[model samples]
Target: NYNVLEQVYDVTKFLEDHPGGDEVLLSATGKDATDDFEDVGHSSTARAMMDEFYVGDIDTATIPANVKYTPPKQPHYNQDKTPEFIIKLLQFLVPLIILAVAVGVRFYTKSPSA
Candidate 1:
């Protein structure tokens, strides 16, 4: 079983074509081969080849609790430390402040009669 999904594959047939050799596949027989398979960094073609050998999925209830897969949780952003609101406000206001100053300087530099 791999990632809580039972993979039915023809080890005998795959062994003949396996680039790593038959011994590697033999060692993983009747066991979860996910770690070994990932560590090798198999090519996309190798992953695609699995489709032909797939039989069907195993029920999640049948899988042992310890071996069940859970996706990694995403890290939460600390908004309090970064002050995102203030950063966004400054981003919007800074350009307007510069434009206002430029206009004021141009007006002041002009002659009263102009």
Candidate 2:
């Protein structure tokens, strides 16, 4: 119920929308919200909401409904073109090097007069 991570996230998000700036939110993060408890109508609902974020088994809380949840697509290693790219590069360069060497040898070995 007293997990600070969720509260920190909520406070950060709230700061973006608050007209009065984020001083209050920053202060609230460190103290128990007891004095301002009755100022808002849904105090119990708020506490209940915070309680759910206490996922003991997991380090991170489940994504909130306001956030559209998306599981990351698995990396498609099959689509990796690195090997193909390297092969193509070698295919183009290898013959060029061999041809250059052959030409150099032919030029040097030709009759000194011719």
What total of clashing residue pairs does each candidate reach?
A: 0, 0
Tell me the lDDT of candidate 1.
Answer: 0.83
Per-residue alpha-carbon lDDT of model 1 for 1-114, expressed as tens digits?
434556667668788888999999999887778899999999999999988877777655575568666999989977756888789889999999999999999999988994
The residue ranges of model 1 lying beyond 4 angstroms of the native Cα positions read 1-4, 63-114
Q: Candidates' lDDT values, in order?
A: 0.83, 0.60
TM per candidate comes to: 0.47, 0.29
Instruction: Give per-residue CA lDDT, model 2, range 1-114, as digits (tens).
Output: 333342323445456655446775567764445465456555565667555434333223353427776999987676346889789888999999999999999999998884
Could you tell me the lDDT of residue 43 within candidate 2?
A: 50
- Taking all chains together, the TM-score of candidate 2 against the true structure is 0.29
Model 1 clash pairs are none
In model 2, the number of clashes is 0
Q: Candidate 1, which ten residues in sequence have the lowest lDDT sum?
A: 1-10
